[model samples]
Structures are given as C-alpha cells and as structure tokens.
Target chain A: MLQWRNSLARHATRQSVSVLFTSVGRRVELMRAFREAYETLGLDGKIVGVDIDPLAPALQVVDHPYIVPRLNSPEFIPTLVEICRQEKITLVFPLIDPDIPILAANRTILEETGARVVVISSNAVALTADKWLTNQFFERLGLPTPRSWLPAQCDPDEIDYPVFIKPRRGSAAKSTFRVSDPEELRFFSRYVPDPIIQEYLSGPEITNDVICDLEGEVLSVVSRQRIEVRWGEVAKGVTIYNPDIIDACVQIARALPAVGPITVQCMMKDDVPHFTEINARLGGGLPLGIAAGVDSPKWLLAKAAGIAVDIPPLGSYQRDLYLTRFDESFFLTKDDRAQMASRCL
Target chain B: MLQWRNSLARHATRQSVSVLFTSVGRRVELMRAFREAYETLGLDGKIVGVDIDPLAPALQVVDHPYIVPRLNSPEFIPTLVEICRQEKITLVFPLIDPDIPILAANRTILEETGARVVVISSNAVALTADKWLTNQFFERLGLPTPRSWLPAQCDPDEIDYPVFIKPRRGSAAKSTFRVSDPEELRFFSRYVPDPIIQEYLSGPEITNDVICDLEGEVLSVVSRQRIEVRWGEVAKGVTIYNPDIIDACVQIARALPAVGPITVQCMMKDDVPHFTEINARLGGGLPLGIAAGVDSPKWLLAKAAGIAVDIPPLGSYQRDLYLTRFDESFFLTKDDRAQMASRCL
Candidate 1:
C-alpha cells in the first residue's frame, strides 16, 4: 500500500486545483474522498458542493456548500459558470446522469471560466441516457447485451418471459421491474410508461469503476459483484479481480471519448459478460474502488493540477475486497449551520 | 367524492398562470395533481418540471421540461428567471426543503419577469430549515414537540435513554436514529457527524396536510395515520378525522406566514398529538388530501392567476379513507427522449 501510494505520484505542472460536485445529493463518501485527496497531497485546495437541496448530506462535509437552483432553471449554466469563476474551480463534475449533458453542452461556458467539466462526450451522454442507443453501442463494439426492445417494437409472442422493464431513460433503480410471464408483462404494459424491456440475464451483476485519463486511456479497472441490492442500489457487494470484465471495461474506455471517471456495469452469465448499462460519470459505489486503491479522485486532482498521474497496470485494483452500506449521520454546525440558515434566508 | 371535488372550487380572480416545479426529482404524482387542478378549474395553463436530472420522472409528465442547474450554482437565481421568461411561467414552487430559500431569495429576479415565486418569507424559510428553530416554532405555538438538545448542551446522566439522535437541521429521515442507552449514544455520537439528540417519542405518527392560501390564512387541514413505513417514507396509510390534530394544524397555519402547501408531522401518544417537523412545501402523501378533496393546487393556481380562493370549512374532508402505494411505471416517448437528447448536446 505504501509503495502503491508513492509510486502513484508523478511529475506534472502543479495547478491550484479546486473541485466542485454538482447535484451532490447525499454523496458524503465522495466528498470525504476528494477532501482526503487534497489533504494527502498537502495541496492548497477546497471541495465545493452545489445542490438544490440545502439539507443534502454531502453539502455539510465540504468547505463550501451552496443551495443553488434547479437544473432546468434558465440560470443553470450561468450559475455554474459563476460559481466556477468565483471558486476558481479547476475541475467540475456531476453525480447525476442528466446533468452530464448540461455540463457538456455548457463545456465552452464552463471552460471560459478556466474549469474542466468532467464528462465523456455529448454523444456518450446521449447514448448512455437512451437505453436503446446504448444497446446499439454495445452491439457495435461486439459486446454482449441482453435482447432489448421498446414497447412499440416488441411482439408479445416473441418476447421471452422474465424480461426486465425499466424507463427508457432512467438513472438509479427507481423504475425497474422484472416480469415473469406474458400475463404479468401484459398487465405491466398497461401502466408501465415509456418502457424498455430487455432479456433478463439472471446472472451475477458486476459493477466496474473504470478510470480513464484525458486521452481516453484506461487507468485502473475495479470490479465488484453486487450480491444484494435494495431499491436498485447495491446494499451488499464484494469486489473481484476478473480479467475478462477488466478487458471489457478497458475496451469501453478505449472506444468512447471518455475523460475522467466512467462507470461500467454488466452481468456475467455462464462465464460471459453481458453489458447492461454505463454511466458517463462516477458511480454511487465509487468509494469501493477508491478504497481498493483505484484513487480516481487523486488522479483527477493530478490532472487538474497538470501533473502526470502514474497509473498502475489495468485490473491491478485489490481483489476480493468487500463492502457493505449502512445508514449513518453527518452534521453541520456553527458556521455550517449559519451558512445553511443564511441560504434559507 | 364528486361533492368534495365540487366543494373544493372556491372564489378567486383568474390570472394568466404558468407554474414551475424546481428540483422536481421523482415527484410525478405531484406534477399530475397540478395538471389535474388546472384541468378541473377549466383553466388554460402549463405545468413545467425543472431538475438537474435530464430524466426526471416528473419531467416526462409536464407539458414543458427543462434540465436546470443545482441550487448551489451562483447562477441558480438567474437561470430560473431565464426559464420563467422564456416559458412565460408565472409561479415557481420548490418541492425540496433547501430550495425554498433559493427561490425566496431570488423573488426579485423572478418577479422582474412577472413571475411569482411560491415561497414563504425568508425568515420563515430559515426558521423551518433549522430543526432547533422549528422546535422553537412549535414551542412558541404551545405545540408539543419532542425534547431535543444539542450534543454540547446535553448532560449524559440526566438525559433520557431510547432517545432520538437527529441532525439539528435534518431533512427527511436520512440522518436520524434511536439510541437505547448511553453506550449506544456515545458510539453513535462519535460517528453521527452533527448530533441533535431528542427525547424519542415512540407512538403512532400522523402527517397533516395543511393548505394555506396566498393570504397566509388556514384554508384546509387533512390528517392521516402513517400505518406502515419503508425506509422512512410512508408506504401504507389511512386518513382519519381528528379534531385536535386539525385544530393544531390550523393553529400552525395561523401562526406562520405560510403560502401554498405546507406539511406538518406529529406523533400521537395517548390520543394527543406532538408536533415533530414542518415542511413548508408539499408532502409526499399529499395525494391523500387531494383524494379527500383539499385542492391546494387549484387554490395556488387561483392565487397565481389573480383569482381569490374561498376554502371550504375546516375539517370538511373524508375520513376512514385508506391508500396503498404500489410500484408502477411512468413513461416518456419520442418528444421526451428528443428533449433529453437535445439538452445534452
């Protein structure tokens, strides 16, 4: 661990790197990870959180927390630009899928303020947002994807039972359902709006936190098997060091014009990996990869500081590491409370 | 049900009203409720969804949907104004607690474009945002709130056990817990970042859907018993006619300079209600009140449209009504997909 941490450090032109997390939600782990990165490097920097909800769990952890506005607001782009300029933010990243395109579309606007918006590409964002397009993306790359179809394109007779239904453009596991038979599918079709039905690959699910650089080169691939899930979020998971999964993730990073962190997800059936979905930004369980020593946050800071990151061989992240998520509390007091109150007022 | 819906229609002067839901997340039912109110009133209007998420479920239901920025963004205020101006929106309401102040603070910017922000006074926003101040709010009103204290203010030996530890300024049930003894309290205190230990009230919980007109007068109060809860949100619930609870809700509405919809929570012990928290915006289970005929949406739209709304008599709602929340689907087709795609590009 000691050698890995030191060898990971490399030569680069140091820049005063300040970071921002948009729509931070309850990402307290991410907040701590970035803060630790700055503290470890002995860098003079700050972590800022931008959230519409003032009471977000992550907001209380950062140096600067602001209750901004909605993503659909007209001031959305301008507001982000202003914050970037004012905070001297070197790197701006978003945790939600929808905000990716907004920041990417406003790349020029944010860049004008001398901030790098961490996103793959506009096309990647669009493809990832639309499941049908993403299926095509996987197909073209010769990667396995379940037989997916929109409601309009589906024939009830042709569709195999136990298919999975989800919102065509959904983030998180909120609107996903598994149907067992034609009757269930028919019943669901009545109310399941804007449905995307895919063949249910009832295999072990794997989450690959794929770290990429400015040149879209894969740095380290950390894979975990989401054994138990609640409400679509991984509640219990164990990390793995699968070579095939790493190769797929590496290929995905190489294929896409990705920058910074991109999350890859797939399911392994009969020793073959079938890709399901990909997020152009960081995944919720990224702390798992960071814990296993992927160090995406520090790498990001290094990039923002114009320092060359010394990445290890792909799939070198620790194997058989385990993680479990439990509910916990975080508080904001004194100045934090004052700032929160001031925002409300 | 028909008479209740009919009784809901009251006196109000009509104005050209367009509404926006900021930080709209997955509140699809709330969006549909507003649209239903407009259609019921025979009024020409539009319901718009503004969120940082490109694929918000609520966004697909609205006539207009835009991916806005985070509230912490410096341009949050200005971006909202631009959307209001471009969409000709007249009223902007926030469903999230933290966003209330953002809109209230930017009332001037929004009003410059002839838009009326649906927020209470900034002071009220601040008071309600801080749980400690909210305790004071209940105290001032002679309402029963649990015994709450700051970690620094608490004396371990004198304090009661099986107590609750919540953030002084907590939103939702994210950072809350029940401690059985000093050992657990001490252990939790070490981790629960900002601790606000309160005398745990173990009893039946009640949610009061209180509606106030633009004039800050009590319009209606509908109470429900949270029979079953999952992950801190009410899953199965039933409505009841409780006079004391209604009286308490009325007193709360009368006490605060509230506008639009406000949600009040309490725990009932020995047939008496003790106030817990106040959300100055809409509640998750508000569909019950709407189902029982407290049409706050119509009243809000009327207020925005320059129409006067005459609410029916207090406690004039259905009783013994039950509601079971089931998982279902909401869809977005070509236009929604196209709009989401366009936002990214």
Candidate 2:
C-alpha cells in the first residue's frame, strides 16, 4: 500500500507542478503580479493562495484558494504547510512577514513530501521581525540604527526625554504615540500592549526593497520613503535614492546568506541612515520597486526554483516612482503630538 | 481608558458568570452532567464546549460551543484563548487529557482576565501524559509498575524475545504489535511510527478513577478492570477492589499536587499492580462509578470551590459490579492479534 501510494505521488508530481502563496489581509496587486509573472514564465503549474479571509480578492485571482484561520498569526505557517501537503505543493511564496518565520522553522517538515521550500531561515526572520530588536541588532553590528529603548525599561535620569512608542510587531503605524514624561510612559505601556520605545530619529522613513541570491549577494535594491501616511499605512510614498541607505541595505543583505527578497526599512538622519527593521518578504511598496526596474519577483522565483541567480548590473535604474492610495486619518492627541514632534522628524 | 475597561469588565463579571469547558471527541454525557451540576448549584453559569469535530454532541448541550481546531495543537490554544478573551470566560475546565498540559501551562495567561483556572500544573500534566514515562516515574519512586523497555533502545543482551510493541502514548491494542525478530520490528515501526518495545506482562488491565484535592490528598479511589475496549477506548468494564492498586493510586496522587480528578490505569499480575499511566481528568467509566455512588465530579468541583469532599462510607458500594455496552468490535490484523489477545468478551 505504501509503495502504491509513493508511486502514485511520483507520477502525479511528474505530471504537474504546484506553488503555494500565503498572504495577510489584502494583497490583490501582489497576487496579480505573481500570476502575471507565472504566465509570462509559461510554467505549467497551479498557484494556491492561502489567507484567513475567505473573501480576499487575491483568492479570486489564484488557481486554488484556501481560507486559513488568520495570516497575522503563528498558525499561518503550519496551516499553509498542511495545505501544501494535501495539494502536493512544489514551491511556497510567502507574501507576508509572519509566515516567513514559521516557514523557515518548519522548512524540513514541508519539504518532506519532495516539495522544496523557499523561505528565509528562522534566524534571519527572527532578526528582522521585531522592529526594536532589529534596530538594536543593527546598532550592535555598527550598521547605523536610530537610538531606541523601552521607556518603561529605560532609566529616565540618563537618557533624553520625549520618545516614540510604536507597537513592535505591526504593519503600518498602529498604536504609535509620543511621550515626554513618566506619566506618558505609564500611559503608553497601558495603551500599547507591545510598544517599542524608540529614540525618534530625525528625518523621514525610507523603505528599500532588495532581492539577494542564496550567498547574500545583492541583485537589486530600490528605495521608497513614506511622504504621507493615512490610517497607519503609507498612503502616499515616493521612491528616492539615498546613498547611505542603499549602502546599508547592501550591507544588511550581504549579512543574510539564506534570505531572499527582503525589504530594509530605515530613516535618513543628517545624511546618515538609521535602520529600523527588515521584512523577510516582499514589501507592500513592491510594485514601486518593480516599476523602478528591480524585477525582484523574477529573481526571487529563480532562486526558489533552485535556478542560479545572477547578480544584476549595479548601474543606475529608474527612480522618482510614487504610489498613492486613500486612507482615513484621525487626530493625534495633545500628548501624541508632543511625542511625535520629539521623534527628531 | 484602562480603568474604564476594567470597571466594565468587573460589572459584567458581577452580572453573569460564564465558564469555558473544552472536551475531546464526542463525549456528551460528561458535559451534560457538568451543566446539570452547575445549574443545580445556582451558579447561573453556562458550559462552553470546545471540540475539533463539528458533530460533537457536547456542542448541542452547551450554552456556547466552539468547534475549533485541536486543543493541543498550536493554532487551537491561541484561538481558544482569543475566544475566551472575547467572551470574557471566567473559569476554564479542561475535560481532555492532551489539553490539560497546554491549559495548565497557560493558566497564568488565562487568569490575567480576572478569571480562575482550575487545572493541575504543567509539570504534573506532563508527568502523567506519556504511558512509558508514567510507569518509569512510578518505578523511580519505588512504587510497583510492570517491567517494560523499548527493545530497540534496551540492551540487546538483556531483552527477552516475543516482546510487545505498544504505542508509546496510546493504548487499547490499536497500534500494538508483537515482534521476535528484526523483520517484525521494521514492519511494526511502519505502522506504529514510534511504538515502545516492551516486555508485555501476562495480566489483565485495570483502571482506577482517583479523585484528589488541591494538595494531592485523596478523597476517593475506585478501581475497574477492563472487560472490553471498543475502538481503542474503554466501552465495557467491571468494578473491582484491589488494595494494592488503591495504594499506588494514592501514592501517585500524593506525588503530584493536582487539584482535580485523576484516573490511573494499571495492570495486575502476580497480586501486583503495574502502573500504566495517570490521567489528569475523569475517565470514561466515571459515569458508571457515579452510578455506583462515587459522585467524582461533584466531589472535585466542591473541593475546588472551597467545599469539603467527604466521600460517603463504602457500605453500599459492591465489588464485581459488571457493566457492558454493545459497540462495533475492532478488526485486528494478524500482527495485532499476535500482540494482543481478543479480550472483547
């Protein structure tokens, strides 16, 4: 019976190829781009999209869609792997950061069925997942990071007053506040469940999408700084070049030997880049980077399929790219305003 | 805002009480009895049944039901806790053995919402979950237990032939196999996955439902030998009085300062009771024991609620009280038959 099952599986695998794609919230544009890429590649395979929301538009575009419990959860990785097993998935493309960590941890488990896994290692994912910890890592490595600390865990007597508090593991700026007093510190901890007390670095935040090879060699790097944020997301963002930020991105990318298609986020302060965090998957601003001539998805897929990835020429690519979307914005309380102003922005 | 939320929570807690009850598989009798007991006590609280199966009968009887994932699984516990937080669950009742360990570990997290967790500690739960480990624990404490060892891990020169390979974490002869050669061991591992190769004792198996207090002081212990197992579960059984078994149960209860019902299974051979495993929650034969004037659940809850559980005199309790149920008999392959004699009658 076991032999029969094995032979049937082998026959099926030889007949068709399968790819698993995991997403959190809405990622219609990313999924559409993926479909376009696969079609252009002329691969005879199926793309399966997994999301907690059954009604997500990305699901509609995929060949096979499975509604898992939630994507912003630890279960996403295991649940997607289970789906992969049932569907005989050949490749996995993580569309979100949380899935990266889980996929990396259980890569062997997913690959047991002769399906190869394409995920950043758990160590790489862990180093980049927590914004505050990522910044600390950069500082420890002398790679330039904004001064950050937990006000609740910090000594007020020695450090500067008025810091920024943002929820550590979140996309967009939710529950982000500015505080200048012990009273505010108390309130901030009470308000934000997992707040990161950061030394608000001066200047704007820039997001750089970089695709690297298996040996930590950078193939392409494109940057975007948030010019406008509405309802905790980059509602309007423009692609720009900062030499320091680009250098830092290359340095960070070169440090991760097994990671692919990671996004480096930082703030440029006085012509110096202060790293904030790294996302181990495609960033939301991927289209801007792709339009700027990075072709990160193609490069990422090549590495995932076990094909050798050639580092693209480091010549100047298209810049001055921008993306705009409508979002709701609310008032920052009086304390919130002071906290925001203190972040040296 | 925190104070207001706290006040609102307090108000709700005062207004109505709701307890969470998580049960495994399709056991409705236990859940119904719990509901009846709570309603009789004028607690005005509802039993919330959680199971992976959508068709679980417990769901029909509970005031609120969650047909979620497995309780021990990574996804299930967090989802269960999230539901508890959203519903303001006050008390958590772990009716399943596997869920006991997880629930016990997260007791502090559950109790953070001004709720009470009535569970044994994680250490106790872990100590009793695995059969081989439980027996080893008994042997370590100088208590009587069946001589057993995994032939594969055992010293080759010391191992006896015709050894029984039992599922390391399960019973009722389902994955059980007997092997006398390397070929048989290879064949058995294919089916059992990780069977414990043990020197199967020639004796009948018996189960004892021992109810203990918070400090591990025994209130009552009832013994029942297995007459039959339907689909790897206790379906037909006969009550018996074995003082040695009773002493072992008391010693185990005393070793672990558990605060709830515990069921200990043993095999009696040569007038000696061999410890198999200890169950943190009530057993399947508890209803029959209750019929025989045990009232285990009432005694347990009373003790947990700070009431005394004084077991009535054993004057009315009679030994050799046999009970039988008609269920589909399991079909054992030839290998299974060699491992376990068909004791169905």
**lDDT (tens digit, per residue) of candidate 2 on B220-329:** 78887776554445645666887777777777887776566788877766877777777787676666566566776565555545444467753235565554332111
Off by over 4 Å in 2: A1-17, A71-79, A303-311, A326-345, B1-345
Question: TM-scores across all candidates?
Answer: 0.52, 0.43
lDDT of 1 by residue, A19-109 (tens): 8899887677788888888877656688988887655667777898877778999988888888898899988888988899898888987
Full-model lDDT, candidate 2: 0.65
Model 1 agreement with the true structure over B163-211: per-residue lDDT tens digits? 8887766676765777877766765565466777878877789998888
lDDT of 2 by residue, A1-345 (tens): 999997776455433457777763455566666667665544456778776544334555577777775555666556766777888887776877667777788788788866666667778777777877787778766887767776467765566767778877876565676667665666556557687787767668888887765456678788877765444445446667767777777877777543557777787777777788887777777766666667666565555554344545653556655554321111222343333234210
Q: Judged by lDDT, which candidate is best? A: 1
How far residue B102's Cα lies from its native spot in candidate 2, in Å, is: 60
Candidate 1 chain A minimal-lDDT segment of 10 residues: A326-335
DockQ of all candidates, in order? 0.01, 0.01
Q: What's the TM-score, to 2 decimals, of chain B in model 2?
A: 0.79
